[model samples]
Target: MTPEEAVTTRASRRSPRPRADAARNRDRIVAAARDVFVEHGTEAPLDEIAKRAGIGNATLYRHFADRRSLLRAVVLLIMCRVADHAERAAAETVDSLTALRRFVHDAVDERVGAVCGLLIDGGGQDSAEVAVQCRRVEATCETLMDRARHAGQIRADIGLRDLVISMSQLARPLPGIEYRDADAHRHLDLLLDGLRVPAPAACGAPGGAEERSVTYTEHAA
Candidate 1:
């Protein structure tokens, strides 16, 4: 089974293990919901998701029962993927900055910000599994930030929230500024470059990058 399938099963752990075909259908539905929700918010028609999954409306209803259950599954799906990316990035590299950038860029491809912003006020956010996934993301981000800060790669004043908020906003699509056409990675390069303090020359003073926010920790808090 795919990692996503594993997460989908875990999200519905209370339910009996579905038959192989039914499990495959559930996985496809949740994966489709993730993409459809990103493209058309949580209020998007159930037909759209069903069509995207190449399934009928009845099948979708059989698996999800209602929109709220589907929404919860989709949220858990994205959150679990986000946490997975963070963990994989850390495991694949010991370079803290590189790992952090990898995680952020992978998250951008997932279009987490758009889905999350739309569902921010939704009841799905209250899911116990959602909170667990969120905590995993936060913990990984914190570890990466601390390592990067100690190595003088990222700014000392920048907290974990700065990195979190940056990833979210960069992935969010704006009017006439869809993510696929924009230089989102380039913009991330700019923001990340801004976060670094320049190394000192052999006999000169170290220079600081232009900061965008000096109070994000408190402001976000």
Candidate 2:
């Protein structure tokens, strides 16, 4: 090929690269926004997220039209991650109880509770999106519950709807309660215990019987 033609071809290839980079930067911004929102709640400033993502306000606005748009993106991203975690938990874990526990913990501690706070605090402005995300979360929970029930780890009579409602109800930090990982696990242990089927005599003692229950004396502000 002629030198001029070769140069033009290279320039054309390089031109789209910047657009790809811009797209990646937008994704990074959204991811950073999700983390910030989860940590600081939905009221977290967009400027802070842009700074954290190493992007400018204009760049962030260029990708996300408004605060609601950004929040929607964050919610969708979290839902997708939760779904992926669910699929992995279902496929990889040999122990259905373990998978169910992991799924519940991930949803409560890592995703659902966090997002639900944001949505509630946002005054349900994005109720439609929130509903969709909730359904996805419920589906994941159902999958785990089904596996646990089939394995006889969870009580066979427990319905997915009941399990989902229980998880949601338990996800919230009680009034005046200080939320902590250890505390969360303690509560989860109780819930798991309630779900568990009674072991046969040959199985001997049950697991987590000696674990201390978390005291939820305070409500989270």
Candidate 3:
């Protein structure tokens, strides 16, 4: 064989075709980890994650060197996805308040908040990439919230911390009960009602049924 042809053949041998099965396995692992983390928090057993993915411990180790690594990957994945959704929500609608409401509703519906809730309780070491991803998500949320506030849709007393804490708290599952996105959404709708300005009462409306907007006092930071 010619020298150039021989070199090309060697390179091809070194770089075999992509392993479709391996790729599928990695995907399954990521998905399973996400679910396990949401259900059991980040401290969930790695072996359980493997079993859920239909893979062995050795395979799980091959893909993720340690639990911290796996947790970071899950955090990064969920953050990026939620950020993408936030970006799309921010741009898709002309009404800033509508966009914010839509984003929050959809986020709760998808249980994105629950993922973050687990991470907060996990207390795992966060890699720089994971931290950066987290900042990105926070910034996106800030933008959405600010826009809504500027549009007079959100109360002046609300802040990013309030939103995050509410999300995490609402996302958490009660003892002996599993987390349900529907339950979260229901509470979120009630919370949103509190955030919005109340409609003005009609002239000569019945007493005691008048809408009252919650008075929010901003505390010193």
lDDT of 2: 0.69
Better of 1 and 3 by TM-score: 1
* Residue 125 in model 3: lDDT: 40
Q: Tens-digit lDDT track for model 3 on 14-82? A: 999859998888888988998898787777899999999999999999988887677767766776677
Order of all candidates by lDDT, from best down to worst? 1, 3, 2
What TM-score, to 2 decimals, does candidate 1 have? Answer: 0.78
Report the candidate with higher lDDT, 1 versus 3: 1
lDDT of 2 by residue, 48-98 (tens): 999999989999989988887787777777776777667777776457777
For each candidate, what TM-score against the reference?
0.78, 0.68, 0.75
In the range 21-61, model 1's lDDT, one tens digit per residue, is 98898999998988887777778999999999989999999
Error of 2 at 12 (Å): 9.1
Where model 2 places Cα greater than 4 Å from the true spot, the runs are 1-20, 117-137, 169-177, 199-221
**Winner of 2 and 3 under lDDT:** 3
